[model samples]
Every structure is written in structure tokens, then in C-alpha cells.
Target chain A: MDFTGIVVVAGNYGSGKTETAINLAAACRKTGMAVNIADLDLVNPYFRTREARIPLEALGIKVILPDRQYHFADLPILSPAVADILRQQSDLTILDAGGDDVGVTVLAALASVLKDKSVRMLQVINVFRPFTNDVAGCIKIQQEIEASAKLHITGLVSNANLLDETTPEHIYRGYDLVQKVAAQTGLPVEFITAGQKVLPLLDMHRFSCPVLPIDRKLLPPWKRI
Target chain B: MAKVLMKGNEAIGEAAIRAGCKNYFAYPITPQSEVAEYLVKRLPEEGGVFLQGESEVAVGYMIFGAAGAGERVMTTSSSPGISLMSEALSYIAAAQCPAVFVNIVRGGPGLGGILPSQGDYFQATKGGGHGDYHLLVMAPDGVQEAVEMTMLAFTLAEKYRGPVMIMGDGLIGQMMEPVEFPDDLKTEPTNKDDWATNGMDTRKSKKRNLVKSLFLDPAALNDNNLALKAKYEQMKKEEVRFELYNSDTDYQVLITSYGTMSRVCRTAIDMLKEEGIEVAMLRPKTLFPFPEKAVFDAAAKDSCKAVISIEMSMGQMVEDVERCVKGQRPVEFYGECGGDIPSPEKIIDIIKGLL
Candidate 1:
């Protein structure tokens, strides 16, 4: 089987990290691969992989979250059970890392297990976030997260958005900012995610790799509209 | 029949297949994801539908939808995911939809640790979700019970037109032990087509079976709840499962425990016995509609001095044990929270103190 390795999604707060993770997992599933998603977003818990579990299960994709006692507003403690899933060779496993450096601490426990595996740790950049508004700031946040996790960032996900009202121009600016940060950090720009409506308007030729589409399912069911 | 060492999580998925459960919907949480991963491939091979739900909230609804169709369906999660599922579990129960839900409990008041813990006993047995309802909860201690109970859960759910829960903990989900699925057992074909909303057929009469928890009138809602309570009372006669160990003598101490913690209690019982202490244990396999008669009988014993409730949480199942033993015996309790699995040695020590 062509193992797509483990996609570790890490980024600053409100960077749409979980959304990117979910949609990317969905994109992979659409290509006829077995996909298993682990909701490791220990940060702001309200919008995470677990929120999308039902639809994912409907698609024959597997989703892993914490148990019932673990609510949305708690620190993420990665279970060793997650390591067992990571070691499996058949499917593509997506780790939807929580927002911010503290949230990424959950992965620090897996440094040894991740050593030989095909793992891609990507840092998502949202220019709208407090500290990571600029290219240098994005790079700085990436270093802080990488230092804390003891893992290098392999790629950059440009998920620039303006909350419930993200426009094509905002996505373009976010992509440009991440492109520069990618150059400085020596990380590849893996994908640029645009709202489904903006997908047709953007120039796909400006970046390398695939331009993954982002649906609105990452939003809370009440906030979806 | 081939028997191999399997974890509680893997056993749940495997048993669902063995039970002829044709549809599975789930969101993975620690200690329980294996249930989902194991089924990802096995379900397709078994000619079943395996869906990775978008969220625990949605997975619960998906199970509700699939079960509503008269298909044998199941979903598994740990504590946090189970919390999200409580709403759906309630709806399924109120709707009398047949399905199986497995909760591999972990420690917590909030995001707690990821180790095995039975903190969800009250939520699970006393109706984790809203409304006046209860799920037919089966607490499995070992891998064999986990697999066997899950299969039984499917049958019981369909038989009662209600939901059944397989409540285990992280230790059970992760621990591996030998399991044997009965070869003579086969899944009975469901007559779901009689009521399932599997697209309209003009040949059938127009009888729409709406599975919802919503009831507009207070009187009707009370009636529904009372009817549900009656159903539970009837279930008490048909489904209360328990295992009595070392109870042949007039024991000075009676230990009531269930699930993974009960396995630890079993070892503790052996140690207590070795020390010339006569102790008896009643491990409840069915938590809800608890083994009341077995507990009452054990408490009525003149030799059984005290009842100590052993659990992984801070005295949750102890409530039910107390309710059963009533004032007939002094019920004591010992436990640890936040994903801590109490050792058999700890239980032995606790028992010694009671003596």
C-alpha cells in the first residue's frame, strides 16, 4: 500500500488548522484510500475533528477522538492508543494538531514513535491571527512550535481567512504571506485552501503541490450557515 | 473457531461482525479508536458498511439513522466522544431504535488523562443522555466478555427495539486476551423492512415510522417515560447478568464491581482468600437494570459483613451497589480518577482494612 505517512497539522490559533486537516483527510478519502483521522486538537476544542465525526463515519472513513469525559475545553493528552494507529501501515492517518504551541505539546510524547515513520508535520499560517500576521511572525511561531514539539515543520498550509466572512482577496494575501514564510523556513508550501466558492477565482498556477478545497463543515453546526 | 488474543477495542469490532451487524458508524477517541480502525477493513470484508463519521455528534445520529433502517448498527468512543454521543443515545432510546454503542471509558471531569478509567458509570447506567430513559448497558471485564457482550448487545437491542451499550474502560480497550467466538452463533435476519424508512415502496401501506424523541404534550411525554420505565422493569427480569465468585461460604465481606475493575477485583479475591479471608464478589455484567436480585441475595447473607464497591472512578457504580445492598449491609468504596487503573494489590489492601 502507498502509505501517505502521517499528516501532522500544527499552526497558530484560529489558523483553520482543524479545517485543513479534515478537508485534506476527506480529499484523500475521495481518491479511494483508507483514511483514519485522529482529532488531537487539544486547543480550543469547540471546532475540531470530533465535530465532523458523523459525516466522516458516513463516508467509510475512521475518526478517532478522546473519550466522553474529555470535553472541548481541556488540555489534550495523547493516548498511547494513538501510537498503535500511527504504526499501522495500511491507511493514511491525519493528526489534526491543536492550535498554538501548547496544543502541539500532545505530539511531543510521540517523538520516538515518529522517528522512522513517513510523517509530514505542517504548520498552518493565518495572517489574521494575533502574532502571526506577518511573514517573519509566521516563521517565528513555526520555530516556537517546532522547538516545543521537538519536530521540524515539513510544510506550510496557507489557510488565511477572516472568520465567517473570508473573501478571495483575503485567501490570496494569506497565500502570499505563507509563501514567503515557506521560503525562509525552508518548508514547502504544501497547499493553499480556499473556500469552495473562491476555488474557481484563484490562480492555481501561483503555488506548488495541490490546492486543496476547504468546505465549511469545520465550523460548528450552529455556526455553519 | 479460531481464538486469539484481542484487545477490548478490537474485540468490539470483531464481535459486531460476528453478530451480523451490517453497519458501523464511529468517531475515534483514545482507547477506543481500535474499534473503528479494526472495522475499517473488516466491515467491508464482512459485507458491512463502515463509516468514519464527521464528529461524535454526527456519528451518534448516523447510528440512529442506520438503526432506524432496521440494520444492525454500532458505534464506539471513549469518554469525551461518548459525552457527545449522549444526546444521540437518548434519542435512540426514546425512539426505541435498535443499535449498539461501545464506550471505552477514560478518566475525566474534563479532557482528563488518556488511560483506562471507569468514570462514566453513572452517566452510562443512569441514562447518560437527557430524558427519562436507560440503555441496556453490558459491562465486559475481559476480552472474551467484551466480544461476547457486544454480540449480545446487538441481539438485545433488536429484541427490545432499544439501544444497548458495551461499557468498558481504556484498560479493557487496550489490553489483549484470548477470545473465542461461538461458531454455532449466527446473526438472525432482521424484519426491519417492516418499519425501516428504506425509500418508499407503493406496495406497502402508508405507515410512516417516525423515530424522534420530541413529544409536544406533557401528558404524552410522561406516558412515554412511564412506558419506558415499565420496559426497563421488564428488562430487569430478562437481562440482569452477573457473575458470583467465591460466594459458596458465609463470607465476611462482599465486593461488588464490574468491567475492567472487576477483573482486578477477581485477583484481589484470590489474594484475600489466600490470607484466610472469606470474601465474595458479585460482578455485574449488565450495569443498567442492574443485577438487583443477585445483589440483594448477597447482601441478605448473614455472614457477609460489609460491601466494598471497587471502581476506577470516585464512587460512581458505588451508587448502584449501595442502592442494591440498601441498608442491609455497610457499603464501603475505594477508587482513583483521571485514567488510573487500580491494582489488585490496592483492592486487597482496601479489603483488608474493611476486615
Candidate 2:
């Protein structure tokens, strides 16, 4: 559960990876530690970590994205700043990659640099999403992430949510799925993310891992509070 | 069945399958590729086919080929991809083949941006291709409406025997919301054998149906244009769907908007109502068979002093709003075509300016 060193977060599409990564960086920074979050997502065109850069930067956390030339594109281009941050042996550096194996393939480009440092690669699992809805599906995603990134996943983040309609039961069920996957893979359940609405309603003692209460930053302009 | 949370793109793919459409063809594009990703895995399980063609142009013809044979077919694409499919769309419409095309519109003059935009309003409502034809365009305001409209697209396509479109923006495609697949939207394709090239033996008829869009003779082409005109007219009469928000009370500003843009307007309306400023909104669900009368009537309200077309585009829909209001009330336009959607506060400011 320690938010130290380089933390790489990968997940299936719609697995709440970007939101969790953004919140994770913000959470780590809240402890008075300098945090830098990099957006290496080359898969999704919208609703990525870069979209919330303004607010994240306003929180005194550094937000890195691809160069302005290929910013909106799903190109294989990775910013040099990301490499610089990866080499920085300081406070928390979270990398939010795109979803699925294809999404994390960009991590393989950083594999050479990653091999030099001890990185905590975490796979976010949302049991409600189509691919990671079950134990086998979660394991498959974990294996895919491991294979494509050429790195081992040290932890799992149970991020089962239904946007504005999320309830306590959803978080509970998500915690159960992450526990099952953790038991099977022997990886630690790093944390569980519940949004502002359902955070108060959840029974905190039921979850073994630490809870990260995330403010929904990546939303449509209309839905934003 | 219980409500499941789904991205609008994935919901659209599932809704088509539930509608008994077993054939789907598409080329990947931003904000809408998830529909293809979800269907490529799920379609085969239902004994349906999902094909990702080399290009949107190729995929559009694949849909045309399947629909020409009386098979329910569909394709999903973004703005640029939809533009590539326009030629085939015109061909399919001319041949009277029933097909559904989903344009999860991103910004564009050409590949403008991958964020949500209503720039395709003119492209969808008016003819994108070279023809005197119109697509039955349904604009959904959210993921749930996207699902319902996607399912209904197949039935309406068969009913009119022409292309129907689910005109969604990128936000609608990428965002997640709880949705239920209604059993009522599940429908069998109807009236196909009468005109489709479904084969003589399949329809149990000795006559072989030839599906062609060409009418070389001048008289024949005029008749074909008239027939297309008749179908569009019928759609205007029976299929015009509009939602009047806060219309029961007399409001000053009448907002004409659709899809995700209207959702923001709805929130703004509620916020404005709390401030004792009542503003009504007329949301047109069908773009081609636009709720012109509804818009005019809503604008004609005694207290209504102004009508504004609030969209995610740079005044693409404002032209239609101006025509519908007929200059009775002063018409205004407000938009942002680049990726950032106009916020409710920004919308409130615009509405306040009109007052």
C-alpha cells in the first residue's frame, strides 16, 4: 500500500484506470510528498489522465503528457519527460497506461529503463467491465499486462464502480473479486477506490486494503460538479 | 435483466444484437472503436458476424451488401470514417436497402479532434453523399438513450428500407452509464422479401429480385427521387420526436439542442429555475424529421423572447434552428467546436446574455 517509487497502473478499457491513477497521484501528494504522474496512454483518445492535467497541476502535482504535436493521437510516441521522471529516484511517480495488452505495449518501450529501477506495476481490476468481470477474466488480464509490459504486477487496485450510480454493494462486490484474485495470484490488494458519493456509505472494515476516496475528475463537461 | 453499467459504444453493439441484427461491419475510429472491440468478441457467440474491414469505405459497402440480401446490418464510425462511408450510404439509400450506421461524431472539418462534437449535424440531417436522399437520424442524449435508439434503428431502417443513423457524440460513446436492454426493442426485420435480393428460393418466389440504384432513364430517375421524397415526408409526419423540457411554464429562452449538449442544457435549466428564471428546451431526437413545428410552437410561447441553438459545433445546427423559428423570435447561436464542451456555467452565461 506504500505509494513510493515508480507506480505503473494498467487495466482493461473502462476499468477506471485513469481516474484511479489521477487519484493515486493526488493521494500520494496529499501526504506532502512531491508526486509526478505521466500519461502514457496511447490507446484511448478521450478521458485519459491528460484531460485532468489542469486540476492535477493546480494540486501541485506534475502532469506529463506526449508532446503537443502528437498529443491527441494514439501514436507510439512517448515523451522524453516520461523517461526523465522514470529515472528520478524521488517521490511517487505514477504512470497511467491505456487499457488492455495493446495499451501497455508502450510500457515495453520503457522496459529497458524500467529494468534498472524497482517499479511497482499495479493492474486495476473493475469486475463490472466486460473483460475483467470474473476471476478467470481478471487473471487473464493480469497475465496479459505482465506479458506485454514485460514486468510483474506487484499489486491490484479494486476499482469497481458504476459512475454516478455506484453504491456500497458495488464496492463490496468489487472488494470481494479483488480478494479472490489476490488469493489466487498471491499479489496484494493495494487499494480500493470509491467515489465521493459512495465513499461515506461503504463499510470500510470489510475491505482489507486501504481505501482511496477519488474525486471524479475525468467526466463530461456537463456532468462535472 | 438487471441494469448493467456500460460505455455507450459497447451498449450500442449489444443493442444491435438484441435487435436481431446478426451482421456488423466497421473500421476502427476513435471514441467509437470500443463498439467494434466489444462486438468482435461478443458477436460470434450469438452466431452473428462482426467484420473490421480495411477501411470505412470498404466496411460501408459490406453493410450495403448484407442489407441488399435482406440481412440486418450495421456499422459504427466517427466523423472522418462516416464521411468515407457517405458514398456507400447514398448507394444503399438509392437501392432502398435497410441498414443502420452509427456515427459517434468527433470534431471535424477533417480529423479536427477526437473529442465529442455536433459538427456532423449538417452531415447527418442533410445529405452527406451526392443525392436527394435523407437518413433517419436519431440523436441520443445519453448512454441509455443511445442503446434504445441503436436498437430501434434496425426496425426503422427496415420500415423505411433506407439507412438510419444513431448520431452520438464522442462523450456519449466514451462515457459509462447504467442501462437496461429492453426486450421491447428486440424486433425481427420486416418487409424484406418483398424487395430484397434475398434469393428466389428464400422468399419462395420464382421471381429473382435485382437490387440496383441506377435509373438511366430521365423519367425513371425522377420517379425514384419522388419515391425517396415520399419516404422522407412520411418520416416527418409519423417519426418526428421531440422532448419539451420545462415547457409547461412560460419561459423566456427556448433552447434547441440535441444529444449530449442537451443534457448540459437540462442541468442549466434546473439551475436557472432555482434562480426563478424559467427557460424551456426543445430537444429534437430525430434530426432529419426535425421537430420544426415543436420548435416553432415552443418559440411562440408568450413569454419566450429568444431562441438559441446550443451545440458542440460552430453553428452547424444554428441554421436549422433559425429556419424553424422563422424569425418570429430573435434566434441566437452558441457553440464550441474544438474539444472542450461548453460548461453549464458557460451555457448559463450565454442564456443570461440572451435575456
Going through the candidates in order, their DockQ values are 0.02, 0.61
Say which candidate scores most in DockQ: 2
Chain B of model 2: TM-score? 0.98
For residues A96-198, write the lDDT of model 1, one tens digit per residue: 8876677788788887888888788888887654457788778777888888888888888887765445667777888889878877877788887887877
lDDT of 2 by residue, A72-186 (tens): 7756778999988888776889999988898999998988888878789888988887778899999998898889988899999999887888889989999999999999999
Pick out the ten consecutive residues of candidate 1 chain A with the lowest summed lDDT. Answer: A216-225
iRMSD, model 2, in Å: 1.4
Q: Evaluate fnat for each of the predicted models and list the values in order.
A: 0.00, 0.58
Please, what are the lDDT tens digits per residue for candidate 1 over residues B67-181? 8777788899888998999998899888878988888887786877777788898888887788788888999877788878988887888878898888898777865455677
In candidate 2, residue B14 scores what lDDT? 89
TM-scores vs. true structure, each candidate: 0.62, 0.96
Q: How high is the lDDT of residue B231 in model 2? A: 99
Cα distance off (Å), candidate 2, residue A213: 0.8
* Candidate 2 lDDT for residue B150: 89
